[model samples]
Target: MKVIIVGYGRMGKEVEAICAQRKHTIVAKVDPVCGDAPALTKELADQADVAIEFALPESAYDNVKLYTELDLPAVCGTTGWYDRVDEFRNLVTQSSIGYLYGSNFSIGAHLFFKLVARAAQLINPFPEYDIMGFEAHHNRKKDSPSGTALSIANIILENVERKKTILTDKCDHSINESELHFASLRGGHIPGIHKVIIDSEADTIEVSHSARNRGGLALGAVLASEWLKDKKGFFNIDDFISERLKYTQMI
Candidate 1:
């Protein structure tokens, strides 16, 4: 497939390398430095089967809408554009285009989320325990708490009846027993760390996923590209799970 890269920074470069390893073509790259207004030329636009976007939060909304408006399927990894998610969904639905967005594209991270959700469901019946979330990322990272952390918090919230909300600090006021605490730390060169800790009178249980580098994310993005090639409408990593499991069952 001919893929256009919308960000030529760290993640975008990694995506390019992964595409090469998979024998896929990188047709064009649009970086922020390229120009102001930062629009794609028709020639570059014509060469793409899909566009893979890993731009910054500020540029993500415009970048995604541009390509999808042009009727190209897009797989986006850029976070912080979620404030306009309803607009994105509307655009995708109206255009009959495909848009797949995930906070983290690592296969391991996605699987970790699935496992955490199931575990939360199992542990929810026991009222003695409560859950909290913590995340760490590289200092250079923009978004705090990381997207994967929020996803995990959502999983815990959905399954655990005790947590009705996620907070950044310990609640001084009386909050719901089921509420989740989110602690975010930014330091060093940490790729990502997300831990879900369940505390109780007896003991504490923690489940976490740590990323060594960008390889997992690069690989997962390629897989997502392949999955998006023939799919239409809005989707997420959750859809990939059942499909992957079904394939595993067949094999």
Candidate 2:
């Protein structure tokens, strides 16, 4: 695969290493700083089959937009810009380019999401079980709760009958029964750690996932880029997971 790497930061560096190991060529890199390719010219993009975007939340929109405008397939790992996903969805609809995104691309994290989802469904029948969770990341991380944490929270909210909303901030007073309190901790050199706690008067159940490093995410991005090279549509990681499951079942 010929690739264009957007954002040459820590994650981008890892992506570069993974691409080389996977034998994928990087055609261009686009970043305000650290970008060697200088600009994402149509000529540069033309040489690449897909672009892997790992930019900051603030600039992610434009980075992905450039790919769509140039008819380049994109696999995005950036978060905090999903509020404007509808805009890009429309762009992808008008074009033949493929776009896939995920909050955390680690396969373990994807499995963790499923475990938490199933646990929520099982506990939904018993009113005694109450769900709450927290996520911790490196101090340099900008997003507080983390997009992965929010994704996990949404799974709980969807499967559990009682969890109607998520509270990502502090609650000085008593918490509401309908609210699921998901806290965030930022410190140390932690890559990522997410935990979902199901508690009751009798006992407690915990489901969690800890990312050892950024390598898993980088590898997943490259793998998704490979899978997305010929596909056309706006998709999320779940679609990737679903396809993998289908193939597994077939073989």
Candidate 3:
């Protein structure tokens, strides 16, 4: 497979390494600082089978737009610019190009989302059980509470009837029982840590996912790229995971 890396930063380098290990060819890189190519023109995009984007949030929309315009399949792992997701969805639908985006491209984290959802569903009817979410990342991380944490919270809100909203800010007074409080901590060099706590007066249950490094995320992104090489239309990690599970069931 011929691949173009859209960002040459830490995650981009990791994607490059994984793609090489998987025997895929790197046709070009499109970062201003460490880009192997000058710019992300249609000519450069035409050289690769697909593009994997891990660029900054400010540039992610433009990068995806260019790839879709060129009819190039793209797998994007950038977060924090999701307000325009509806716009990109329309673009991908109209252009009929393949595009996959995820907040965190870790297979384990995806599974963790499912597990958290199921837990929330099982705990929904129990009024005594209260749920709260907490996530911590490296200080250099851009978004507070992290996108992965938000994904986890969204799943819970969808499944648990009581959690109608998500609150990320620090709570000065007592938190409402109907609101799901999400606390974020940024410090040190922590790769990532997310926890969903379910508590009652009698018992407490906690489910967590902790990443030791970026390998899981990079591998998942490369895997998504390979899966998206020949496909068309917009997708997310859930679609990828669902397809894989179907394949596994058939086997």
Best by lDDT: 3
- Report the Cα RMSD per candidate: 3.1, 2.4, 2.3
Worst-scoring 10-residue span by lDDT in model 1: 32-41
Candidate 3 residues 1-251, lDDT tens each? Answer: 99989888999999999998999999998888979885688887778899898989999778777887788899999876889999889889888689999877899998888789889989989999999989999989887978778888899899988889899999887888778999999999999999999999999999999999998999999999888878999999778988997888831
The TM-score of predicted model 3 comes to 0.90
Q: Write the per-residue lDDT of candidate 1 for residues 85-170, one digit (tens) a residue.
A: 88888878777678888877888887888788877998889888877779989989887767677778888889888778888765
Model 2 worst lDDT run, 10 consecutive residues: 242-251
The global C-alpha lDDT for each of the candidates, from Candidate 1 onward, is 0.81, 0.88, 0.89
lDDT of 2 by residue, 1-251 (tens): 99999888988999999999999998878887889876687998888899888988988777767877898899999887878989868887788899999877887898788899899999999988899999999999887888788889999999998989999999887999899999999999999999999999999999989999999999888888888879999998879877996888831
Off by over 4 Å in 3: 249-251
Candidate 1 achieves a global lDDT of 0.81
Clashes of 3: 0
lDDT of 3: 0.89
C-alpha TM-scores of all predictions: 0.85, 0.89, 0.90
